[model samples]
Target: MLIPITREKFEQLIPLIATGPQYAYFWGKLPMVLKRLLISVVALVVIFLLGLAFGEGFYFFRLLFSIIAGLYWFWGPIYWASRRNLEIRRYKYSGFWRGRVLDVFVTDEIVGTEETVSNRGELVIVENRERRLNVEVGDETGFTTIMQGPLRRTHKGIAEGQVVEMLILSNQPDLGRIAKTSDIYIPRLNIWVSDYPYLQRVIFAQVSSQLSEAEERDYPDNRAVINRRRRR
Candidate 1:
C-alpha cells in the first residue's frame, strides 16, 4: 500500500537517511585520520628534538625512520577522515522520503550536468531537469555520489519529467549568503540521486513498516464511546 507522506515527513526522514549506511561508511573512517595526523605531528617533533641533542651520526637515521613511521601512521587515517568529512558535507542538505505520486513530465533534450570526485577518487555526475523550477537539494559542502556501476548510467538517461522520488541533498537556507565575490558559489543543492532501485525498495519498506506500527499505536478502537453515543 502506498502511504501518503507530507513535506514534513520528508523533512523528518532527511536526517535519518543522511546518517544511514551510505554516510556511516564515510564518517567511520574520520577518527582514524585524526589519529594518524596526531601521531605524525608527535613523531616529527620528537625527531627534531632528538637530532638537536644527539648530533649528526644517528640524527639522519632517526629522522628518516620518523618520516617513514609518520607516513605509515598518517596515510590510511588521513585518507579515511577526508572521505568521511566529504560525505557529511554532501548529505548535510538532503534526505529520502515517500511521497504521493506527483505529476510526471518528459523531455527529449538533456538539461544541465556537472561532475565531481569523491575522496576515494570515484567520479559522480549530477544532472538536473531542464525546467527552471527553483528546486534546491544539497548544501555548500557538496553531495556524495551514492550509486555505482550500471545504475548510475541508467539515471544519466532520466527524461525531463519524472515523478520518481529523489534522494536529494540541499543546503541549509540559514547558511545562505555570499561570503566573498570571487568565492565559488556553492549552489544550495549539492547532490541528488534520482535512480536507485534496490536501495529505494529497502528504505521504503522500512519506513512503511515503522509508519504502520506508529499509526496502530496512535489510533485504537473505543467500544465504550460507541455504545454511549448509541444510547444518547
Candidate 2:
C-alpha cells in the first residue's frame, strides 16, 4: 500500500533540498535592486556624455533622462524583487514530488508537421493520488529536437504500465490545473535525475554554503546566492 504525504511536510523539506547550479544561476544571484540601480546610473552617464558632446543646450533632455532614470531606479527594482520573492515563496510553499510518468498526451492531431509548436506539454495534473497540480512544459528548440530523436523512440518503446518519476508543483488539492511543473534546466546533469531527492539535498546545501560565504564577506546588497543569511 502506498502512503500519503502532506503538503506541510513537503514544505519543511524545501530548505533541505539542494538546487542545481544552473537553477541557482538563474534564480539566485545579485538582488534585482542593485542591478536596476546600475542600469539607471549607466543610462544617466550616457545621457550626460551626449549632452556634453552636442552642446545643443539640451538641458531639458538631460532632465527628462534623469526623470526616466529615477523612475527605473525606483520602480524596476521593486518589480523584479517582488517577482523573485514570489518565485521563491512559491517554490518554498507549494512544491511537491512524485514518481510517475508525466504523460504528454497529444490531444490535437495534425498532418505533415515539419515544424510544430503546440500548447501541449507535460501537464502535472494528478487527482487524489497525490494532489491536483498543473505543471506545463513548453517546447524549446533543444527540447523539441530531443523529443523528436532518440527520446521519442525510447519513450514509445517503454513497456505498458511502466512507471517513471516526475516532480510536480501545485496550489490546490482537487483541481490539477493550478500546478506548475518543476523543470530544472541543467545541461551538465541528466534532466531525468535532476529531481532526484538526493540531488535536491546537495543543491540546497551548496546554496546555503554560498550564502554563508557571502554573509561572511559582508557584501549584503550584492549577495545573490544567500537569502536571509545575516540571521542565520
Count of clashes in candidate 2: 10
lDDT of 2 at 88: 42
Lowest lDDT 10-residue stretch of candidate 2: 141-150
Tens digits of per-residue lDDT, candidate 2, 1-232, equal 0112354544443433333433343332355457667888898888889889868788888889888986785556345444443464464224222222233332222211233344686444332221121212322221110111112222333321222222344555532332444333221122332212222444433443443464558866756533322222
lDDT of 1 by residue, 1-232 (tens): 1233444544444322333443333333545467667777787788878887888887668868787767855354345544543443343333332221222233333455668897899999976444221212222244212121212222333332222233333454332331211001111112234311213334444554565456556654654533332232
The CA lDDT at 176 in model 1 is: 35
**Prediction 2 TM-score vs. true:** 0.29
Any runs in candidate 2 off by more than 4 Å, and if so which? 1-24, 27-82, 88-163, 174-178, 184-232
> What's the lDDT for residue 52 in model 1?
78
- Note the Cα lDDT for every prediction shown: 0.40, 0.40
- Model 1's alpha-carbon lDDT is 0.40
